[model samples]
Target: MSIICKYTIFYLSKPLNITTSSEAMLNQVRSVHNVRPPRMKYPLWYLQRERAKDDQQLTEDNRAFVKEAVHDKFGMPAVIHGISTYDVRSALREKSVEYENVEWSPKFQRTGLIARKLGNYPMWLNNGKSVLTTLLHVIDNHVIKYIPPGEFDPPRKPYSCPNHKKNLGCLLVGAESADPQYFTKQYCGLFYKEGMMPKKHLGRFLISPEAALQPGTPLMASHFNPGDFIDVRGKTIDRGFQGVMKRHGFHGMPATHGVTKSHRRGGNVGHGGEKGRIFPGTKMPGHMGNRYRIHKGAEILRINHKFNIIWIKGVASPGETNSIVYLYDTLLPLRKYKSSPPFPTSKVVEDDQLIDSYSEKMYKFTNQTITYEEEK
Candidate 1:
């Protein structure tokens, strides 16, 4: 299918003003606001200014900003690996996330913290308070060095994740917003000694840099392609312990027709008198959530080629807004790309015409709800 645009939504930001004395035309001339772009004008602001009479159009800077965004062979919002550490202390305090650059290829997913699932309660809102994270331009993140799998002696200090080779891979990230003075020499020394840019946040991708990218390569939205099926795994919001009625979806006791205090309770949880101690795994309230969970097989919707921003399929993704999400190609057969993915690592390409030509279907959203209209 071809790319389709032009969906209009009205926003009530302020009162609109109309001039009675101003002369008007009979035929619609696609009048636009002089103060804002057509995409942001009436929906975000109150009044739409008349199209400028100067006829001076915006240069590349004004018409629409263009940045070469990443498109990929994978689905949208590519599966990014997430970390689960109760240790809030392990953070750089500035709050950052990580990733690795695939070689400048038209075959990779875009970058950043991606998206985190909030909950299963649905994210759409009438007040506009619940939109997913939007893309923000950050400085091109640089790779420090290719931390080979095996052990090696550095001229200065040892590297991060020194013990396990399998656990560590390539590190890719953006500019440092953290305080340099707060860091240790061992951390600081690792980068300066190797002639790599020091990073505030460090993330390791599963594969080799040579396969996906190179040392010192800059990762961008253009790194990832659209129409990907990503597997998002993250620590769900902790809800504490809950009962089987709530957690396991058990049918509780009858609430009517002579039912008394037993209502809403799991009646007869035990078997006989001798074996009366509530059996193991009996539906009872304990801990609810905050566990590591994965929402698999979500489709990538629209991608802003300029911002590397992605709109995924469902709102049921894993973490909260602004939370960090690791992205990569899916491992599951059902969700994996039907076409062969670029193996080993991706190659850097300048034109990205290959990306424009690849066959991909963006995700779609519908006004339908999940309902089981069946009775047992």
Candidate 2:
């Protein structure tokens, strides 16, 4: 009787060649409980995974010829010069020019600058306290293009601004001019309209339409003043696949007491009974760093106009030495500048004499020695 029962169950489990109404009904019922896979957030072309470095396979002579041709086409890289100081003063005097017409309000947002992290050093304060600062060099930056609010289209998935009515324009800024021969034609075309050389780094800044800058306008370290708080955005150093002990700072098992090979393992991932699955974001060991992080409210301790370098407070800024970082105004309400800062951008004269600007609290070596007086 047991054998007969087993044979009957096996026969029912096997798929039959003939399609029956009952089987069709069973399939339809199963389909109703099936969960669909998540859809892609961005378009296919948005991936842009193609290698940026192109191998042209050109000979040494061919490369030299290409370089010479590019040099002749766009002479030696133009010196980044700002609007004449006279013109800037005239605009302020007249009070009728465009610069005066569009005053920087609290609601207004301006463009950002691109800078390279050039390591860090310590600075002394007037109170005899030491503060570590990171040196950021702002290379030759230029305004590439400006897209108006209505025409500017960004990715829809990661919507930063909650308000739908706020129309923020987009400003394309490029830095570190490079030879055109190294970049592809499509990349070079971006700078062709402005008659500028191709840039190594490109950044997009969202700003109010009123702060729109003309293409080819130069951006320098003077865009930000000393003592103003700003935000630094950069990619963190890439520390590939790491263990939980280092990555998540997990406390491993005791070295003694006969602990086996599971010292660094994240034991007991899921509960045994009802809640059988592991929860998401469980801080398990995986690929770490190489993420876009923003270090906010870093005060500008010093500014060097001669070399276009900015000394920002703190050595904890994201990224390793010599990595690219983006600088913009801080969003922190308390740290936000009460007065307007270089609306559109700062303009300087060719014969400008300002070399270094330092914060009041900072102790400059050039100043006289401090003297302590006895109380009267």
Best by TM-score: 2
Where does candidate 1 stray beyond 4 Å?
Answer: 1-145, 152-177, 182-200, 208-212, 260-264, 267-270, 273-283, 338-376
> Scored by CA lDDT, what does every candidate get?
0.42, 0.77
List, residue by residue over 11-107, the lDDT tens digit for candidate 2: 6435643335445544555454444455555421132322378678999999888867776776644454321111110111222113334878888
Specify the poorest-scoring 10-residue window by lDDT in model 1. Answer: 1-10
Off by over 4 Å in 2: 1-68, 77-101, 157-166, 369-376
Q: Return the TM-score for candidate 1, rounded to 2 decimals.
A: 0.48
- TM-score against truth, every candidate: 0.48, 0.77
Please state the error at residue 31 of candidate 2 in Å. Answer: 11
lDDT tens readout by residue for model 1, 1-376: 1111111112221233332212132133466534333342221112222233454455876433321111111112222212221111111212122334334343333322333332232233322234342222222244444544342222222344435435334444434323223445566555444444334555545453334334445444344445566666556666667766877777877879988877656567787779968888777767877676766766554444333344555666555555555555665677766664443333334543332221143212343543345787
